[model samples]
Target: MKILPEISRTLSEYLLIPGLTTEDCTPDTVDLGTALVRHRIGEESGVRIATPLVSAIMQAVSSPELAVALAQVGGLAFIHQNQPVEEQAADVRAVKRHKAGFRTIEVTVGPDTPLGEVARQLSATEQGVAVVTRSGDTEGAFLGIISLDDFHLERHGAHESAGSRMRGRAGLVTAPVTASLSEANELIWEHHLDVLPVLDGDRVASLVLKRDYQAHKTYHRASVDGEKRLRVGAGINSRDFKDRVPALVEAGADVLCLDSSDGYSVYQAKTLEFVRETYGDAVSVGAGNVVDGRAFRYLADAGAAFVKVGIGGGAICTTRAQKGIGRGQASALLDVVEARDAYARETGVHVPLCCDGGLLNDSHMAMALAMGADFIMLGRYFARLDESPSPKVQIDGQWYKEYWGEGSQRAQNAARYGQGGRMVFEEGVDGFVPYAGSLYDNVERTRAKLTSTMISCGSTNLRDFHRDAVLVPVSAESFKQTGAEVQLRRPTADH
Candidate 1:
């Protein structure tokens, strides 16, 4: 057993490449956007902006709903494989079938829905338009369209004014289902309409909302798969890969990640080969939880689309302390990145490198990105979100979410480990996490901070950040100096 500190420097004392920024390049418009991930994108590939975030393999942390939420925000969630194949597959299906691709159905209501109800729905979304359809069915016949302003009328029962119909029906314009994004945009502009319902023979198949067109005009990246549905992924253990992979694939999971504390086993190698050969390029798989260059090479050779790196760096992981088989996150990440680049140079295949743990905050995420990680994976962070499966409990009048590692006794038992498989050697722990209101708030805030970091580093896009980022080494004392705070404590104790 060897301590990580003895082997490598930890993330607490590392950095990203810095840059000279001019006032012209602002964080708000710095284009810190990601390519909508469908299949895995390699780090050195021209279109290699993998989604910025992912959730680690914690069944209680990443729920089906959390997976959907993450996808909508240009990230992926590995629906944990710790549950039954049926349950895990359902989780993947929930995310895959969540939102129809190219179809904006977020704000929809029934025709008979009163103005009050409609307004409430409208207020819940940031989209400028509210849609009315039969039975409030997203794909039902279009009834009418309403604007955000319609809800603001202070007249008595102003909500009811929308009535059995809204004013926009008289001017209701729609695009054909076959309409491309450009055609939809053109229709919106030509009709001077704020919303265009996409029709598949009188049924509203989709809504080309104005705001989405305006927002993503430049990048044109939505979290859609080849099916045009929101892209989703699921985790599968090597032991259950044969059974789980097919079910997850059938459920429309666009990618499968090998969910293991360690991914360099012969079992993983065989499983990776099976997925790649059977599914071909139809599905991408992330293989790992290994540390360093050699492990990265092994997974890449085993048909891993991307390699996950990090060992015992998780908040709940005790692998380093108990087993002493983990490396510091910064060192592990750099080694894998180097391996990925070297592999690309030799084989013309650039596998994406993922940092799977030790991201305590946005600063760590920024460092990982600038250090060339295609994406960052998190567990405890997502476990605290309202959408996660972590049960909430009250502690001292404040709410906290339950979080546990896959290797914990609770998880292993739920997974039915040791019945006929591996021995019961817990590598992670169960703990409480402070309540985080929603996935949107938490993920968006992280994204915002990362965007700011990119701007400060004078990089317009993720690729630029990775290519030009400057790592300025600083001592522990120096790093502490930047955040040094002297607290005045008032102790209250029993007499």
Candidate 2:
């Protein structure tokens, strides 16, 4: 057997050499916008993201809530397919139904409902507010609103009906459906109102909360479709593409991705063919988890909108140890990127590359983009956020969120592993990640760091970063020297 001479390398083994800092190259000027699909050379991609990041297709990371949050922050999340088709489609619909500055009246109660039940419903909502509608339907006749501040369970007996405590519509300040978001916000702050229900005739159409307006102000670069709904993606396995594709499309999924541990196979090819034949160019589907240029070329030629580059490199993945069939993440990305450029030169089709998994920090993300990735896919990063579907638990007085791989025993997603109808063994581990606060805060910080790096590299956009950025190999000792040398101070008791 012949062996390659070059050694496999990881992103940590290299460091970016800073370039000239031009006067115009600043973080504000650095544009992270990137293509999410294949397009002809010199033509803009049909699907593009304002940010070059995406959440992974795992049960613990991507959910309807997470999808909406990420889309609002200018990124995208692929809803996992570990469950039934109907459930996944419903999750897609939930994301599609999301309105940026408006809150759907999910927690609603009738006027006669007990305060105890209203409390339960309000507690389940993030806003701690509930609408008191005539028939308890979200769009039922307008009545009033009840919040935690309106009454306390101890002061106002739990047995009291919501009608007894709620502020009636006649006294409440309401906005017409034609009111703009800014106008609603103005009314909310002017009247010291917690929520301004937008009424369509006598029915409560939707509620605009103070916090939602503030969130919109913070994340104004939200990714949306032509209809102004949040953009969301869904993952599909090769085995169920025939049945799953139509349902996801009908449910308003903006894009589809073929999720597999090893996507360079006949199964993925057949799935791509079926999607292309049935939906034409209307459905943008990506495929991957490849480790070489050959695999990249194969998928690109087979009509993959974008190809994911990485294998056995996820935080929870054990494919390399269990099966010994994977390459180094950095090396894998380098090879695929080379092929991608060549393919573009030959056919004039510029298929984007998604650097999936193995990224540990903002530095790694910058290195991935510098090495020629159009976007990055993150599992552990997003899994730690409040938006993730996983529940958080306290361990040793430290909060952690549950994070598991699609191939883990907890997930039992056999279709992702392509191991018959059942999983013979686990190829991933169930674990926990430190709880990071909200998606907006973390994503903003990440964007700042990445943009700062681009500025240092003298690049104002991703295309310039790809062309002008330079990286050099670093020794193990040099890598260690990059961290702090002195002993770190211990945190105070108060801190």
| TM-scores, all models, native as reference | 0.74, 0.85
Cα lDDT, all candidates = 0.74, 0.90
How much lDDT does candidate 1 score? 0.74
- In candidate 1 the C-alpha lDDT for residue 294 amounts to 86
lDDT of 1 by residue, 345-404 (tens): 888776877788888888998998888887888998899989898789999999999998
Q: Candidate 1 versus the native: TM-score?
A: 0.74
Candidate 2 lDDT score relative to the true structure = 0.90
Q: What are the RMSD figures for all models against the true structure?
A: 7.1, 3.5
Deviation in Å, model 2, residue 457 alpha carbon: 0.9
